[model samples]
Target chain A: MEKLFYFSDLFGVAVFSITGALMAGRKSMDLFGVLVIAVITALGGGTLRDAILDNHPVAWIRDDTYILVATLAAVGTVLWVRLTRPINETGLLVADAFGLAVFTVIGTEIALQHDTPVSAAVIMGVMTGVAGGVMRDVLCNEIPMIFQKEIYATACIAGSLVFIGLLELGVAAWIATCLSMATVLLARLAAIRWRLSLPRFHLLDRI
Target chain B: MEKLFYFSDLFGVAVFSITGALMAGRKSMDLFGVLVIAVITALGGGTLRDAILDNHPVAWIRDDTYILVATLAAVGTVLWVRLTRPINETGLLVADAFGLAVFTVIGTEIALQHDTPVSAAVIMGVMTGVAGGVMRDVLCNEIPMIFQKEIYATACIAGSLVFIGLLELGVAAWIATCLSMATVLLARLAAIRWRLSLPRFHLLDRI
Candidate 1:
């Protein structure tokens, strides 16, 4: 079980790192800048979770493997982009969906283990799934995609709620995890396919 | 002594919150957006510091006063801007300097309490002082001032190193705090006055 958890976690880290590297590459960031953003994108969410839960020695600082994977992913993506001349946007989109799904489930599970209220757990799950990408986009000097009505954070919230609800109903952990991940992955893919997004919530000229 | 620390901490929160509110105002953020930015700006740095140091529950989560002060600062700034028409650049600048100085010294002290190595302590101090503003800038979709060769993070670094050095030299806690805060305040104010900044570190399009 622990090994499965680590595998999924590292898998999400690698995909997110690639996305981060590609974003930095597009911005013409230096290698160092690319690596920094990659690490922040891959690790920032879990770090936030651990800090909020008071779990010491944040995941990256404790394991080292996460950082190592992120570094490799960043370097690998950069090289691929350099050689290919253009990014595979579709592939990137698919991988990002998987990353979001995996991260959201893991975050919700951790929060549940800590016995936080459902609302707090849901919030942490969304933060974990989306905050890293937000940090990445922000560091790259862009508004976060989640803030752009992209159905991003909403998907995380949906998956997290479903996961927690199932666990509350005494569902097996493995089954619950699979169902939750599928929910996020499919919902995000559908949103991408249909170009679905929430209406912009502009506060009309109160200024 | 504890009262003094609390006072300084709350003061820093208020000042940073105002600065955040002002920035959000410039971006034409709605009242709700303004408040969010204000809270993040006030609390983001210390949150990052505590997370990195493995301090759980973060300060604001542990204590309600930080959130209260931030809310008041945000509302007050928004009201002030609405009533006054133009934000007072000079007043905001001075208060921001104080925020940076006080937050830096306090962060250093906390890290020392955690028994971090000197380098880590200094890093936590700088992060605590400057990261909130970085987060504010990012959320407002602006390039962070610290990243733009502004003498912001440098000032934090200078003050933090000085504080830790003094503590090592057996300086009284209060004296070290005062001196360190002064260092940051003077350095930042001078930077603003003279328009001093670092040379831009452009990565010559290796992509």
Candidate 2:
């Protein structure tokens, strides 16, 4: 179970790094800018989650492997895109959905281990899933994609709730993790495919 | 000494919150958005610092005072703006500069207490000074003002170095902190007054 979690975390980092690199390329950022944004996009979420939960030595700082993986993935993506055709937008979204699902489950489990309140656990999970992308968008001078009507954060919240619920019902850790990941992945993919979205909170409309 | 630090911390929070609220107003964000940005601006830097330093139970989470101060400041700014003319840009920048100075010194002190290396301590100090403003700009969907050719971060780095130097010279803790804060404040103010800036990193030109 531990090994599986570690591998998935790295996988998520790699995918997020690739997305960040692609975004940087679109902006025509310099190589240094590309690398910085990529690393931040991959590590920002987990860093926030650990800090909120009082987990020490932030993941990338503690285990050099996380940094190495993110940096390499970012560089590789830049090179691949240059050599080949640009990755399709749809493909990028699909990879991002998978990364979000894995990160949400991992964040929730970590929060639970810290014995945080369920509400806080769910919040942490959603933050872990989405914060990095939000950071990336902000750095790129765009409104965060999550704040759109898209079902992104909602999917993370739902999966986190499912994971906690299954655990309370005595489900095995591995089973709960897998089921929750599927829930998020399916919701996100459906949203992408069908343009599903929650109603936006437009305060101006009411005022 | 501790009491002084605590009061300064709250003052910094209040100033940063006001800056955030004003920025949110300029962006035409809703009241809720204003509050969210204000709180993040006031507390985000300290939160990151604590998390990075392995300080458990983060200061704001450990004490309700920080949140209370931030909320009150945000709401107060909204009310004040409604009752009066918009704050002048220069006034806003001056207040932000003071907040930056205070936060930088406090961050350095906390890092020193944690026995961090000088380089890490310097980085932490700068982060604490500028991160809240960076977050505010990001949320407002603007490129961070710090990245402008401004002397903002340079001031923080210089003050952090001064603080450490004074401490090494066996200066009183209070003296070192006060001098450091003054150094940052003066440097920032001078930059604002004179339009001082560092050289821009024009990667495109180099390429």
Candidate 3:
């Protein structure tokens, strides 16, 4: 189970690093900026999770492999973009959604392992899923996607609940994880394809 | 002692909020963005402090006054900027240094109150002092000052050590706190004026 979990984490890290590099590339940032974003995108979620859980030494600090993978992924992304002029934004978004789905479930599982309450686990899962991308956006000098026009965090929340429900029903951990990922991925892609958006509450406008 | 400590916290929050609003104004962000940065800058240190200590109901969540003050500070800054054209960036940076100095001491004091080790307290203090600015930078889409050039976190770390040293010498808390704050402020300003930067390890390139 632990081995499977580690593999899943590696997969998520690679996908997220690619997304980060692609986002930074869109802004025509320097190589250093691209690598910084990639590192943040890959490690930001797990860092938050460990910090909140008081699981000290953070995940990346504990193992250097995550950083290694993210660096490779980032270099690979830059090379791919250089080779193929005009990177595909939509394809990167899709990859990001898939990464988000896997990360959310994995984060929830880790929180659960730490004996956090179900509600806290769910929230942590959503936070872990979206924080990386949010950090990437923030570093890239753009409004976070969470506060913008996509059901990003909402989908993570929904998928987390699905994972919890499956656990309650005695489903195997791997199966539940897969279902949760699929739900978030499908929801995100559908939202993107159909242009779905939550209502913006402009409390500032009224004041 | 408690009264002085509380006063310092209030002063720090107000000054930090002003600094945040000033940065937002420099970037020509809207009122909402300005307010967001102000709140984050004001509450950021305490939030990280409480989180590291694993305290429940985070400091800002428990005390509404902090949030209220930050909000008012942001509003006041917006009005001031609108009525009075461009503000002095140099002046704002000085205020930020003072804010960072005060918050570093306050954060260390809180950690000590929680019975944390002196080393942990020092680290927590530096984290508190720097985390808010880092978050603000992330939100505004700029490289965190700590990660780039500046004596930002270094100043906080030095101050925290001084604070701990003074406390160990049976120095009065108020005197120690004031001295520590002054240390951080002077060090930070000097670094900024001199364009100080730590050696960036090119270990990543080797990887």
Q: Which candidate is the best by lDDT?
A: 2
Off by over 4 Å in 2: A1-47, A56-141, A146-207, B82-85, B199-206
Q: Candidate 1 docking: what grade?
A: incorrect
The TM-score obtained by model 3 is: 0.59
C-alpha RMSD (angstroms) for model 1? 6.8
Predicted structure 1, TM vs. truth: 0.61
Query: For residue A25, what is the lDDT in candidate 1?
Result: 82
What DockQ results do all the predictions give, each relative to the true complex? 0.15, 0.15, 0.11
Off by over 4 Å in 3: A1-4, B1-47, B51-109, B114-207
True lDDT of residue B3, candidate 1: 95
First chain TM-score in every candidate? 0.95, 0.95, 0.90
State the displacement of the C-alpha of residue B70, model 2, in Å, after optimal TM-score superposition: 2.6
lDDT of 3 by residue, A95-203 (tens): 7788888889988988778776666677578868877877898777796656555577778888999999999899998899888989999999998999876643222
Between candidates 1 and 3, name the one with more favorable DockQ: 1
Interface RMSD of each: 5.1, 5.3, 7.6
- Residues B13-51, model 3: lDDT tens digits: 888888777666555555545665787788877777787
